[model samples]
Target: MGEWIQSIADTYKAICAGEAPWVALGNFMNAWYDYAKDQREALVSESLPALATSSLEQRRWAAFCVASVEYLCQRYGLHCPDWVYQSQYSLVEPWFHAVNPHKPQVRARLIETTPEPFTRRNIYCGNKMFANKYEFAAQAGTTSPNQAI
Candidate 1:
């Protein structure tokens, strides 16, 4: 397998092995940014459905897997695979991507701010939850006074 594919597989394995969903998602997003455009398209159209389906069968982190894939697809303007739209991928209850001591107010705010892609899957997180370093750099551009010569 290609390195990008392997990296994504490793991230998925980590998620299945009990890594925190948000942390695994960060790792996944970083690896995703490294994928070439064709690879990214293939990943979304071919590979992600298997991973999401496996997570669903495992009955652990299924919502996170589906929502993360859909979120990435939406961000990049890719076509989300049909399996992601199945009823099984949607969580029966809302899952707030928060740590212990999850505050009710925080959950409320997340519910308010989470993007449609995630909210539809019943996965709630900050609107910027998927932002990565590459996105930050792109947004920063070269105009910052602090940029090195």
Candidate 2:
């Protein structure tokens, strides 16, 4: 992999390791989006779906990428429809959808700040849908993982 890709990979690893994850996650996502913009259809349609049946490691990496996008949306005031983060909103959807790549689908007014709202964000619990660093910072100006609580 190129140094740029490798750096993003490292950020993903650091995030899994719980080391400066918020910053690393942001960096990794920025790089991923940049690359995605270049690759366009092939990356979103072919590359991402290829991971669906890939080996465990590759699949995990794919999941990490999806999660990173969700994280960026939540943290950066980018809006996503509540459903976008859910499993139903597969990685392949963007290729077919004409929406702005950087912005979320749902308007900002509808995005709940709570970690686990009354409405389930996904088919599985928290497979996605959680606050970003800014959301965490707003609450007592501290970061606390809410799902566990």
Candidate 3:
């Protein structure tokens, strides 16, 4: 998880606490860059500062990331990959939580999964490889390298 991801948990807490507009424009821009996924990088890079100030505005931008997910997908059509459900949505979801941490009607969601445990089997390769050439010849009862005994 990213620092921003951790901060989203914090942001959720803050939003629940009734603080006004805890989100910043930089947060929106970073999330948008992730959402845009290279298609809007240069634009976000150049346009972010203009949108970065004011807590209310920042909060609104973050909310939009959540609110207009379907609309944006429709607007971009095939250009937007399915990754919006992955990283892009993830990056913005915290802001959505921040915006509506206390919304009882809405169920805030985040993906929490446990990875499968890794067990090393035969951890070394040499034992699995074929035996040496001489050992094979000796095992076959061959006295000469080219002739069978």
Candidate 4:
């Protein structure tokens, strides 16, 4: 398998092994921005479908994975795969990706700022939850893609 595919598979494995969805997604995004265009395309077309279809005991995690992948695809201007839109990939109840201590305020903020890609799948997170990694790296004075990675 290609390196990018392996990277995505590793992210899936990490999620299955009980890693936080946001953490796994952050790691995946860190690597994703460094991959070549064709490699990124390969991941969008191949790895994401496999991840979306994989059976997991935790329905919420499964939904989060699908939503995250769809969100990434949309952010990068890739055509989101049809399988991502399947009803099974959407959460029955909305998931707010924030600490529980400030429930009402967090929910209100998420409702206002969560991007459409995540909201469509009933996964609500901060607006900048999946911002372009490369842009952030550049802002932090990392001149090289490899440096960011």
**Residue-wise lDDT of candidate 1 within 38-102, one digit each (tens)?**
56756555433244346442343666566767778888888877766777667776778766418
Q: Arrange candidates by TM-score, highest first: which order?
A: 4, 1, 2, 3
lDDT of 2 at 86: 49
Tens digit of lDDT per residue, candidate 2, span 44-142? 222223323354434344454554444545654455334324463333322211133234543222233312221232111222333333444455555
Candidate 1: segments with Cα more than 4 A from true spot: 4-10, 35-38, 47-60, 100-102, 142-149
Instruction: Name the best candidate (by TM-score).
Output: 4
lDDT of 3 by residue, 29-138 (tens): 34433433344322222211222334553544333333233233344452333322332222322322323445543322211211111001101111211123344566
Write the number of the candidate with greater TM-score, choosing between 1 and 3. 1
TM-score of each: 0.71, 0.29, 0.22, 0.73
Q: CA shift at 25, candidate 1, in angstroms?
A: 2.5
Candidate 4 TM-score over all chains jointly: 0.73
Give the poorly placed runs of model 3, Cα more than 4 Å off: 1-14, 22-26, 34-65, 76-149
In terms of lDDT, the poorest run of 10 residues in model 4 is: 44-53
Q: Which candidate order results from sorting by lDDT in descending order?
A: 4, 1, 2, 3
Candidate 1 accuracy as lDDT:
0.64
- lDDT string for model 4 (18-56, tens) is 887668766767666764445664554544334444554
List the lowest-lDDT window of 10 residues for candidate 3: 114-123
> Which one is best on lDDT?
4
